[model samples]
Target chain A: MKISVQADAFDPGAELNAFSAGAAGAGAVVSFSGVVRDEGGRLSGISIEHYPAMTGKAIGAIAAEAVERWDLSDALVIHRHGDLAPGEVIMMVATAARHRAAAFAAAEFLMDYLKSRAPFWKKEYHADGAEWVAAKDSDEDALGRWAG
Target chain B: MKISVQADAFDPGAELNAFSAGAAGAGAVVSFSGVVRDEGGRLSGISIEHYPAMTGKAIGAIAAEAVERWDLSDALVIHRHGDLAPGEVIMMVATAARHRAAAFAAAEFLMDYLKSRAPFWKKEYHADGAEWVAAKDSDEDALGRWAG
Candidate 1:
């Protein structure tokens, strides 16, 4: 499994290629990407900021935990932190396994953890002004599904 | 999300970027790839062939089903219906969702349907000879998973 923090948009085909590069026995891989969107029928764009070292460390820890928890052959977590406009990418996760279930579980696991566990924060630039979006209680609720 | 059958390897990063292209509301997106493996300990290489029209139709049914089944914002499926080397890609599925679960579920569902329900046949080229591989009973069992 591999994890990274980058400043620019990544190429999904290339990233999938990289993860499949070492695949031999593996049959299935699962991945996810988070992107900035225009929401509320009004918000135009979003700008995000994160401490590079801390964000990378936190993502690494999350990936490590996933490796230990699942029978993954390969996995990746690439996150971007900086100013992003509507339709810009924020992050992505890819998981591979001998079977589809494990890949699915691990992919979902990393995404939920990244949302609730990562220290990186986001500030959306909207029509009114810049605002730091708080992590949702619903997001916490999303994590609940994993523990059980 | 977009799905296709190609003769070349795919880029996961690029597909993810495409899936998340216009959405700013999505906080997460998930994707999965299925690659040809020579590690069945049984094959020296892998080759795939399919009924082109049926393959596209079958995949479209699965992807459309996923959209109805999950809260997905976008989804794509690309598969190659020709010879592939070890470490070469066979197929890929990418998805975008508001959260991870839907993306994860839809991706998994798409994969399961592709493997067992889709209309494609894979032939393995081995040191001994070449033989077509049939979907295992286990693969169908895996399909029962989504049968609700």
Candidate 2:
């Protein structure tokens, strides 16, 4: 497994390919990229904040746990910090496994964990105003399924 | 929606770019690729046969239905025909939506529908022998949940 937190946008495909490298017996590789969107211009951009040390450790822990939970041949995770404009990719999660079930599940499972567990503050830039977007109660609710 | 049965491989990032084209409202785009695995060293290639007209129509129709079921903005379905060697990709499913849920669910649903409903025949070539591999009964079992 590999994890990186950076200020620059990264190629999710390349990251996924790197994860699946040397995985000859691997039958499936699944990945997800979280892109910054305008929300149809409902929101313009998002400024994310994080504590470098704790954030890195937290994310690493999540990736490690994911590796244990799934029969993954390999995995890659990349998440960006600092300011992100609309249409920029915010994060990516990729998994390679010997079967489709493990790959697909691990990819989604990681994203769900990231959205609800990763400690990052996102301030939404909106046409109306800018505000620190609190983690949604609904997002927390969604995370519950995985925790149990 | 774009549906094609090809002998060539595809780039997911490029296909994703096309899927999100002209759809500025798309906030999240999710994709999945199924590649050929090293089932055997002598597995030089395999020939994929499908009912061309019906397969394309079924996939398009399934994608259209998935868009409704998941409220997707756009979807693309591409699969291969003829001979495909190990390390070659077999199919790609991409979906764009206003949220991650719609994008993720729809892409998965499209895959389930294709695996069960599409009329595709696969013949495997190996050193020991050559055999025709039909879509499994368990694959049909897997699709049942989607209909419900």
Candidate 3:
């Protein structure tokens, strides 16, 4: 498993290739990428802040749980912070397992945790002003499916 | 939507990058890749055969259904035929949408259909002899979850 919280821009395609290569014995791989939407041209960009000391540890713990639960051969998570323009990739998760079901489930599990529980603050910029974004009700609801 | 039934080997990462670029307004992108498992060193390789006239059309119809059901911004399906070595990729499916739930669901739906219903024949090679592989009951059961 690998987790990284960084401000630099990275290529999702390259990262996926590297992760798949490292997953030696796996027969299935799944990946999810979250991008910043343009929001009908009203949005300019977004700035993200993180609790540096706790973010990585928190994500690592969740990723480890996913690996154990799904019996994954490998897993990877990368989240970007700082300023991000519309259409830029904000975060990504990848999982590898012997079966497609396990790989897909693990990837979805990681994404749910990240979207709802990860310690990241986002501020969106518009033409008039910028405002802090709040957690969406849909995101919280999405997390509930895995609670049991 | 794009569907290809071919014998050529293609890079999954490169394909993903191109698909994401074309997705334009999507906020979530999900991908699943199926690879040939080594089967504990007992397996040598496998050869896949398909009905050339129907394979492409069948895949295209399923992909179109997924896009409509999930309201996808884009979708892609690629399946390779001919001989494949252990650890080689057999197929891939990708979906892009405005939300993660739709993207993940559509990708999984496509995979379930491909595994159970796609018109592909498989023959596995062993040290002593080769045998035609049959569809797994588990794969068939997986398709039930998506039914109305």
Candidate 4:
């Protein structure tokens, strides 16, 4: 498993290709990417903040849990912080396994955690102003499904 | 939405990039890829045969169902037939939606259908001989999850 929290822009295509190449024994690969949405053009962009020291460790733990639970051959998580425009990829999670179900489930599990429990703080900037975006009940509910 | 049933090799990375570019206004994009696997080092490769006339139409219909059911912004399905070596990509499915849950569900639905119900027939080649690969009960069980 690999986890990265960086401010630099990344090419999902390139990253995905590299990840796939490294996962030699995996027959199934699943990837999920989160893009910034303009929301009817009212939003200009989004600004994300994170604790650099703790962010990678937190995400790594999440990825490790997913890898272990799913018996994944490999997994990757990449999150970008700072300003991001509409259509820009904010983060991505990928999982590789011997079967499609495990890969898909692991990727979704990572995404649910990222949306609800991860340490990233998000602020949406609009034409009028900017405001902090709170975690949605839906996100929390999604994460709850994995709980025992 | 786009669906292609081709015998030529494709770059999943390139297809994924193009699909993401076309799926604007989508907050979540999910992609799944199936690679040819050589189990126990006894396998050489695999040969896939498909009914060319009906393959595209069938997959397109499946993609349509997923788009409408998930309210997806866009969807893409690509399948390659003919002989494939280990580690080569055999098929891919991508779904774009306003939310991660919808995107993930739709992609998994497509994969389940492809594995069990698609028109493609697969034959696995080994050092001894070649054997036709039949659909597994697990694949049918996976598809059953989508039934109403």
Candidate with maximal DockQ: 4
Per-prediction TM-score to the true structure, in the order listed: 0.85, 0.92, 0.97, 0.98
Question: How high is each candidate's interface RMSD, in Å?
Answer: 2.6, 2.6, 1.3, 1.2
- Chain A vs. true chain A, TM-score per model, equals 0.90, 0.90, 0.96, 0.96
lDDT (tens digit, per residue) of candidate 3 on A1-148: 8899999988888898888877658989999998888988989999999999999989999999999999999999999999999988898999999999899999999999998778999999999999999899988998888977
Model 4 ranges off by over 4 Å: none
The CAPRI category of model 3 is medium
lDDT of 1 by residue, B50-104 (tens): 7877877888889998988887777788888777877666777776677666777
Off by over 4 Å in 3: none
> What is the descending DockQ order?
4, 3, 1, 2
**A-chain TM-score in candidate 1?**
0.90
Question: Individual DockQ of the candidates?
Answer: 0.62, 0.50, 0.73, 0.74
RMSD (Å) of each candidate, 1 decimal? 2.8, 2.0, 1.2, 1.0
- Candidate 2's C-alpha lDDT? 0.77
Per-residue lDDT tens digits of candidate 2, residues A1-148?
7888899877765565555544556767766777777776688789998888787788888888777888677777788988998877788777777767777777777888788777778899988889997777877776766665
Ranking by lDDT: 3, 4, 2, 1
Candidate 3 positional error at A12, Å: 1.0
lDDT for each residue of candidate 2 in B40-122, tens digit (9 for 90 to 100):
57686788988977887888789889988888777888899888888777888878787777777787788788887887888
